[model samples]
Target: MKRTKKERQQLLQETISENPFITDEELAEKFQVSIQTIRLDRLELSIPELRERIKNVAAKQFEENVKSLSLEEVVGEIIDIETDRYAISIFDVKEEHVFARNAIARGHHLFAQANSLAVAVIDAEVVLTAKASIQYVRPVRLGERVVAKAKVNEISAARTIVEVISSVGNETVFMGTFNMHRSM
Candidate 1:
């Protein structure tokens, strides 16, 4: 059934609230509407573009005190985070991220997303990945969005253990356990 403009606009707000880093193209696909329609709805609703949303989020993350590393260095757009606990980031696979032949994303991109998230979750002045145990569950193709969630599983004065899971939609595509060293 086709949704009325009001319903679609309401849902759009909710969706963007949940994932502020979402691109207009992604929104168009999700809402099954034209990109121009999504843009018009956004303008009507006073919603900012994806770049602006990300800038706002980057500023907010800085305010939230992501101490270990700069927000810019992280592999994806971090949507939710609290240092020393958990963090969630979104990575959208594009042409450059995937192999030319099969359009499958390279393993290191997912690995970096998880590893950097693990570092970002640590409460420290300096953080480094000492070791990592990672698994690639499936191949992620072009245009897919990978959401990586990092949770600190253990901690000490000098070290920390974080578990990161990267998923495309509901399917797990990558998993990593990172042992990080932090300066006290």
Candidate 2:
């Protein structure tokens, strides 16, 4: 069934509110409309684009939550962070991150994405990964987006244990256990 202009706009507002990271192209596909229509609807509704939305959310969340690393120092776009709890980030595998011959992303990029997030979740003035045990489950290809989730498993006066798992969709690409040194 077709929805009226008002109804479509209302639904667009709800959809974008629920998932601010959704792109215009995805909205267009879901609403069965052209990308131009989504853009027009967004303009009329005063909704910013996906990049701006992500930046806005990240900025607000990071200000009060992340303590160890500045936003610019993060290896990827951090979508959520809770100090001494859990945090999540997204890294898009680009051509520069992959080997030219295989188009497979290098392992260090994934490690950095997870390691930075581990540090970001520490509720301390200074934080550093003192030891790490990591496993690479699969090779991520160029253009794949990796979502890294880090959780604080334990915390002591002088150390924190963080578990980080990175995935492309439902499949795990890499996993790491980081022992971080923290100082108040």
Candidate 3:
């Protein structure tokens, strides 16, 4: 079934609203239209590109929500953050993140993405990772998008335990338990 121009535009707005991280290519594929058409629809609707949208959301959320660190200190694009509760970020493995020979992403990048999210989820003025136990479940290839989700498992007066899991789709690529010191 074909949708009218107005109908398509309305649905496009709804789709983008539902998932701001969606790419133009994904939208085009879902709507059964050219990428150019999605671009045009987004432009006419005054929606920014994925990069700008991520930056805008991260900046706003970091400034208003995160107390442990600045925006630049956090790794990846932080899509959601609730201090002392939970936080989520998306890391795209690029050429710099992967080894040239194997095209597999280095472990440190995944660790950094998860570690930073753990810190960002803390509500204290100063938060530091005192200890971490991590496991690399699978090798993430270049161009894979890593979604790191952090949750505060327990919080003491001077310490917090954060559990972070980084995944590509439904498969876990990395998982870590970070013990953080929160200075009051």
Better of 1 and 3 by TM-score: 3
TM-score for each predicted model, relative to the true structure: 0.73, 0.79, 0.77
Q: On residues 51-113, what C-alpha lDDT tens digit does candidate 1 reach at each position? A: 788768866975678887787898988877888899889999999999999999999999989
As for TM-score, the candidate ahead, 1 or 2, is 2
Model 3 C-alpha lDDT per residue in residues 1-184, reported as the tens digit of each score: 9998789999999998888889999999999999999999999999999988877876787899888888888889898887888998999999999998999999899999999999999988899999999999999999999999999999998999999999999999999999999997
Instruction: Arrange candidates by lDDT, descending.
Output: 2, 3, 1
Q: What lDDT score belongs to each candidate, Candidate 1 first?
A: 0.91, 0.94, 0.92
**lDDT value for candidate 1?**
0.91
- For every model shown, the clashing-pair count is 0, 0, 0
Question: TM-score of the candidate numbered 3?
Answer: 0.77
After superposition, the stretches of candidate 2 with alpha carbons farther than 4 Å from their true spots are 1-39
lDDT of 2 by residue, 78-157 (tens): 98887889998999999899988999999999999999999999988899889999999999999999999999999988
